[model samples]
Target: MDNATAKNIREGLKADCTKCFGLCCTALNIVASSDFPINKPAGIPCVNLQNDYGCQIHSHLRNKGFKGCTVFDCLGAGQVVSQVTFKGQSWRENPKIREKMFRVFPIMEQIYEMIAYTAEALSYDIPYALSDKLSAQLKEMQSLTKLDAEQLLSLDLVMYRLPLNKLLTETSKYIRESLIAKLPGTKNSKNYNHERADWIGKKLRGKDLRAINFRGAYLIAADMRNTDLRSVDFIGADLRDANLMGANLSTSMFLTQMQINSAKGDINTILPTHIERPSHWIN
Candidate 1:
């Protein structure tokens, strides 16, 4: 019953709940913070959780330190486990089954991964030549997603990830094709097109440049730690070797996945969009 490592990476972006059962919040103990109020035990609902299964303090989570809750995405692991596998008999409505729901939560997280991968495959704009093969893989992944709770709980995920990686490689190529092509032969550099001029290779730590359009500029080896870059457009900017430790760029925009992954960030760095800083960047 080993859970297969999913071949799809797109699932990480969109966790599907139609196929999930809300297992993580229901089965796990979300630590008490100013937002959640109560440090409920495993399988027990948070005091903030209402009868409708929504957090009563949803809007005020950050004011309380439940900041962790905002970033905790089950990747659609909850809904799929509850309604899809268990036939909607889990803890969303009935409180008595909380204990059993907690036990099944982790296993359900694994099972939802398969569905996650399948969903990613469907998002592709693949070449016509590869459509048939892609369709077959998608169908096979969907079938695995329908396994019962017992079967899902016993899954071995180590072996599952290998095939998923292979499938993801193909999907990624198609996704790239779906994006609007940039201008031909344009160097991948940052352009200070906005009122903010270029600052490539500048030693500018502790400088504040919030709300600037830094598109298509070269910021190689720039020292930008502890600076404010909130609401900056980093499209086509080359931030290779830029120091972003302890920087505050909250509420920034146009920082694509590639830019964030390429640039360094630690817990000390305050990210835009309320993302939790990485551990490495912690002070």
Candidate 2:
């Protein structure tokens, strides 16, 4: 998907904490780390979560050593559970439903994430036959998000995501292969297939890495500064602390907000238009 598609999908799929009941703060397990200052169990609210379902230290979350909260995007699942599945009933107001609501929150998260990926896949200029198949799959998954809390809890997320992932993989091939054939001097897609690569802390700066498949790669803390990352597939790549300063990822495939949030960048780093540069990034 292009940057426009990314922006549009994100406008819809991005988190709206205002409409949520602090599901991410309450329902998910948290461990102490550089990302978080304390341990919090599942179904328990964070110390900073207010009674009105807002984070008391939201504006200063990173300053308060809660960097984990900043990178966690629910993909609009929190509101869907808060309003649709449970019908605006909060764990506090209806304590009886608290455990079940917590259980369904994660399930909804998976579904929403899958839906977001499918929507992104449909934005590609692939063949009509493939587009129709992707559209159908997208609709099917979208409908599942409207199911009741009981139904959502029972959903086999892994089973649903498996088939959708295959479709995404196919779409990735079509996108990368087409771009590979277009970029001058670049070899075939197979020549750059670095799928599941282990490149932790590897220095690869200022390289012409067009159309490379870095899917499922361990790119953690890798020095990728000023590299040409256009048409690179970042699906399931661990880019934590990766140095992306001055790099060009304007046409990268399968890139997500979470991935962008975790990595470092600068004003000169050209990102796909859909991703807003993080405030922590250097100017």
> Considering summed lDDT, which 10 consecutive residues are worst modelled in model 2?
1-10
lDDT of 2 by residue, 1-283 (tens): 3435644764478788899999999999999999999999999998999999888888999999999888888888999899998999999999999999999999889888888778777776888777777777877888998999888887888888888888988988988888878877746434789899999999999988878899999999999999999988999999999999999998888788889889989999998755778888899
- Candidate 2: give the clashing pairs: none
Q: Distance (Å) between predicted and true CA of 165, model 1?
A: 0.9
lDDT (0 to 1) per candidate: 0.56, 0.86
The digit string of per-residue lDDT tens for model 1 on 1-283 reads 1012222333244455445444555677765554355676776656565655666766766576665555455655576667666678756566665566577667656544544544444444456545455555556656666777566667676566566545644554444323213323332343323523466678878976654556567776788988877645564577655788888766444344335544666677776442334332335
Superposed Cα deviation of residue 189, candidate 2 (Å): 9.7
Each candidate's TM vs. the true structure? Answer: 0.49, 0.94
RMSD of each: 11.7, 2.2
Stretches off by above 4 angstroms in model 2 are 1-7, 186-190
